[model samples]
Each structure stands twice: as C-alpha cells, then as structure tokens.
Target: MTDTNPIPARLAALKTMSGAELKKQWRALFDTEPPLFNRRYIETRLGYRIQELTHGGLKPETVRRLQDLGEQLDGGNIATRRIRTDLKPIIGTRLIREWQGTEHCVTVTRDGFEWQGRPYKSLSAIARTITGTRWNGWVFFGLKHHRRAA
Candidate 1:
C-alpha cells in the first residue's frame, strides 16, 4: 500500500506548482524515500508528475529524462508496469520521434533526438538499446533514488 498522508499533501502541492517548482518538488519527493520497495511506487508517482508537466508545456529535457526512466523500468518485470504507467502522461502527447536509419535504435522522443529511425525518449534508453544492458542515470538529470547497477 501507499502512504496515505504524505502522498495526498504532496499531490496538493503539485496542483499549484509552476514550471520552475516542478523539478524541485519532484526531487524532494524522491529524495526522502529510501529504496523502499521495488521501483513501482517511484515510477507511478513520476508518471503523474510527467502528466502535470505536460500541461505546462513539457520541455525537451524533461521528456528525455522521462523516456530514460521508462527504459530503466522496462526490464520486462513488475517494473514494466510502473514504466508504462509513467508513460501514460505522454501517450497522446507529441514527441520529436528520433530516427536512426539503422535496423536498431528506433526510439521515440519529443526533442528531436531521432537519428536514422530511432526515437529515443531518454539517453538511458538509447544507451541500453545500444549497449544491451540495464542502464541507470547516464546524463544525471538529478533524479533521486536512482538504483545503481549491481
């Protein structure tokens, strides 16, 4: 189960947030929590955060970070659910759509990271696809509790 009190208050604060406040709030929320359980909780909350930002005009950098997080959560396990949920905010939103022109590297983005036929959402996703391993924060967008690879 989730924390009833903290989440509600946090959600309330998010409602009145501006673009500049978003990143800070997000960082604060994630920073306090230890690696409590799996990444599901973190991913879900982040998904909603993305949705909030979408209305404020999702910046390219934010989109890239979200996409990268999605990839990390997409190891085809329970984490995938969280990743998918996080992606919900951008489901219908327009992305830059990266193209790599190669058999691989087809990633989706919203900031024109497309090369060939790939549309990467974040750098981590790109690194994973290119390197073929679970990648954590590569670009360091200041996300809290990013689990380091063992």
Candidate 2:
C-alpha cells in the first residue's frame, strides 16, 4: 500500500531541494526574512518548522516544562528556583561567612576575588584556607546549598 502520511515525503523533499527553492520555502513557512545562516541550518530549521506547523506544535504543558528546564540551565536553583549561578555577582559586592566565631568577608572583583586584602582565583580556595578543608565555593559562601532540603 502507498504511504498515506505526506509528512515523510515533505521532509525528504526538503533534503533534495535546491538552495533557492529552500529559501522560497523558508519564506513561505517562516513569513520573514531568511536568516543568514548556512544552507544546512536553514534546511534543518525549516524541516522542524514545517513539521511544527503541520503537527500544531508542542503541548502547553510540554512547553512549560521546557521553559522550566531552560530556567535551570540559566542558573535557577531547585529550592528557591531563583538563585543564580556563582559566576555573576555585581562587582564590589561583599560575601560574608562566619568561621570559628570570626567574620570573614569576600569582595567580588573584575578578575577574581579579594579576601582579607589578598586575591584568590576561586571561593573554594578561600574557604579551604579559612577552614583547612575542601569545600564547594558556592556552598561555602551561601550561593548554593550543599544538600537539597527534604
């Protein structure tokens, strides 16, 4: 029996179409200026776009789940779902930690960190020197929690 699903044929035709034909198809499918990306990129994106248009795209719940995953990848934490990654704190911001009843302060700098008038490459290094043990820099400085609360 002949294949009744036309989507497979449409996708296959995308692979065989000439560059100019692909550009025309892209304009029709996307209704905007074709991106300056290479032909392969155009082909792959067009293929997906065509399928999405025909199949009506992802469900709302799936889209929300993807957005949540994207937020995590961009530095959202599990507990608060708002804590950003450690690499980005404003310059001159002070991070404080208490050890053995002594207050220690770390200042964010353009290049690295400044603690106790000395420059350090990472917060872990500062934490190790202060406590004499290995520690995750983010957790040590309270940017991240070492364990997720149950």
Q: What lDDT tens digits, residue by residue, belong to model 2 across residues 1-150?
A: 887988889889998999889989998999988899898899899889988998889999999999888676644434334433355588799999999999999998865589999998678899999999999888999987788788
Residue-level lDDT of model 1, residues 76-148, one tens digit each, is: 3453444435433343343232325533333334342343566655546664665577665233222235666
Q: Which candidate is the best by lDDT?
A: 2
**Cα error of candidate 2 at position 60, Å:** 1.4
On TM-score, the leading prediction is: 2
Candidate 1's TM-score: 0.22
* Consecutive 10-residue window with the lowest summed lDDT within model 2: 76-85
lDDT of 2 at 103: 97
The C-alpha RMSD in Å for every predicted model, in order, reads 15.4, 14.1
The lDDT for every candidate, in the order shown, is 0.50, 0.84
